[model samples]
Target chain A: MALSLAQASDVVDAALLKARELGLRPLVITVLDPGGHPVVIKREDGAGILRPQISHAKAWGCLGTGSGGAAGARHATRDPAFFAALAAISEGRIASSRGGALIRDKEGNLIGSIGVSGDRPENDEAVAVAGVESADLVADVG
Target chain B: MALSLAQASDVVDAALLKARELGLRPLVITVLDPGGHPVVIKREDGAGILRPQISHAKAWGCLGTGSGGAAGARHATRDPAFFAALAAISEGRIASSRGGALIRDKEGNLIGSIGVSGDRPENDEAVAVAGVESADLVADVG
Candidate 1:
């Protein structure tokens, strides 16, 4: 089944709560459907001005590359020029970072993704994983 | 005060409710803060794949020109060249259409904007206005 709006909102809400509990900086969280369309986005009051855009790019990158944001970062590490060209082609919507995690169904099919921004890259990824798990979905962070 | 995330989501919720009440087609609704950053976006099931991007562009255009989408359309009509240049300069982020409306606070200061897509432009504008008003904000649609 496609990711429901209610599920997306739940993921974002859970992620934000996790961020607060961890004492991370204010965050921006975004959830995209399998087709790379945004379903929900939440920007905390004190988040950096660019956090929303960054979180969106991270999730878009996950959808575009069929990989988690951490995997994208690894790919970029090995091929900076190619990643840069990809970013240019996507109009800067792809971010090779660690805050994006792919969402999958029980059958192991890609469904959507969650992206979080505000803290260190690893911390962001951890929060995204927590959010995805909270929704009882698989997080394809690898 | 700036547009809060709660307020933005409320706008999207109200807009979608209106769309349903009007028997309009599935829609994509987007809200952008005054700085042109996305605060909330919701794409209904069956909405066209491009609706989110189109809605985002509409709202961004409204913020960029400090005018509602209808006014942007009028400006485009009067000076197509200038509008075209603007689209090019903004890397296709601006769309001069009739589905975007500026949001203002009680004091009449610009707060953000809402954009709706997936129907006739005028109908989209009507729905957006309904949403902004539902949130107790001004809808600058003139």
Candidate 2:
């Protein structure tokens, strides 16, 4: 399903709210389209300066591979060589790590992805998940 | 006091090395000229797919503003009016934040910049500083 810009923005806002509710420090969050282009982004005050770039890169990784965090996990796992090449080719707009997640619509169609940075990997993932669920989208955890 | 390509490459090498030494996993490191043009880059295997883009954008922010991390820190300060315009004007490429450092010669000449991502912001910034020092250049921290 085609992802609306509104949905993307909502997802990001929800994620930011959840982060605040949890008393987590600020974060940089980004949502990318299916083609790996940025759709929306938010940066919390007191978050690091590099967060927006990092978050966009992570979301790009998810969109580029269409596989979400699994792709980042693999880069951290079995495929170091290929991952490096991918980084070079993409010109540094992608990051495969624990901070990214895929966004899908209610019909189980891929919509886009959300990426978060400025925290622990697991915490980043949690914020993204919370953000998606808050937007009322089915964030496929599996 | 232009940074020679060799020096820039060395900066990238040292940044990547430091990232590994810190057990921060693989990273994508990039060095750019004062013009925000890339001079050299090195991506560690398994660094994630979008690292290169993030690195480039981070470097671009430094080059564009010529202030290293000042732009990033400004946004993180959360003056919403300024950040909103920044985000709009940057076309999603301007990311003013930590993890980037302006490269200057001993005489305080603006030469280039160093940027790192794919790890924590603190780790990323540390590696970037190491890179600038490795090239015998001053980091624009002040």
Candidate 3:
């Protein structure tokens, strides 16, 4: 099943609420369907300008690696050069880092990913987790 | 929705007026929304052929930094490696230094950014700021 625009908007809106609840900085959030196309992308007031692209890369990286950004982070640690080359191969789509999580249906089928940026890495991750869960989808922060 | 086309066009026109008033070189200007998509772009007659790309890069850089071009310039001067890597991450959409400003609403919500080229960095930035202000928007050069 594909992620709907309405669902994606809800995820982003919920993420913004969570970020506000946590007193974190304003954020940029993006949802990508399994096909690696963006379902929705939004930036909050005062969020960094590069946040949209950065968030896209984070979520896309999750899809490409088939794990929430965790797998990519591991690859970055285990083989720095190889991980560095990943960006070039992906044409700058992969940014192996935190703040990204996989979304899955009740049956555990991959839905896509939620990405948040504009704060500490862990804070960004927390917001993404909140977003995915808010949509009643499983969040694989892994 | 992103910044409206009419507003973007107004920004461009005002920037052009400012450039002429200051006796600056024929310039090119560009506006980009949060999604890093162009809203408007215009080049004055006799402007350098590269002005379009250069101005777009400057405005895009402002968005990438989550600030006006000034912060990016500071980053470039203080940390060339990090800035270079950032440029790579943004796929050359960023050109740090000047000629760009963040546009915000009265509530300080970032609407987009404007960029000007074909003059000295400060002069170009002034033109950009003037353009943003003409729309009754805040021009954040920081």
List CA RMSD, all candidates: 2.4, 13.2, 5.4
Q: Where is model 2 chain A poorest over a 10-residue stretch in terms of lDDT?
A: A79-88
- Name the lDDT value of residue B110 in candidate 3: 79
Per-residue lDDT of candidate 2, residues A1-142 (tens digit): 4468898888888898888888887899998776677788889999998889989877777765446775567654664433543454465666768888888888777778788998888888899999898888866433
Clashing pairs in 3: A49-B63, A49-B66
Error of 3 at B140 (Å): 0.7
- lDDT string for model 1 (A1-142, tens) is 4688778878888888898899998889989888887888888776888998899999989999898888899999999999989989999998988999899977898889888888999999989999988999898977
Give the per-residue lDDT digits (tens) of candidate 2, residues B26-82.
688888887777789887864544566666666776776667765565554566456
Off by over 4 Å in 2: A1-142
Model 1 CA deviation exceeding 4 Å by range: A74-91
* iRMSD for each candidate structure, in the order shown: 1.4, 10.5, 3.5
Task: For each candidate, give its TM-score against the true structure.
Answer: 0.89, 0.54, 0.64
Candidates by TM-score, descending order: 1, 3, 2
DockQ of each: 0.57, 0.04, 0.23
Model 3 C-alpha lDDT per residue in residues B1-142, reported as the tens digit of each score: 4568998899899989988898999999999887678999989999999889889888888877577788778767865533543565688788888888878888887788888899999999999989988988888888
Top lDDT prediction, candidate number = 1
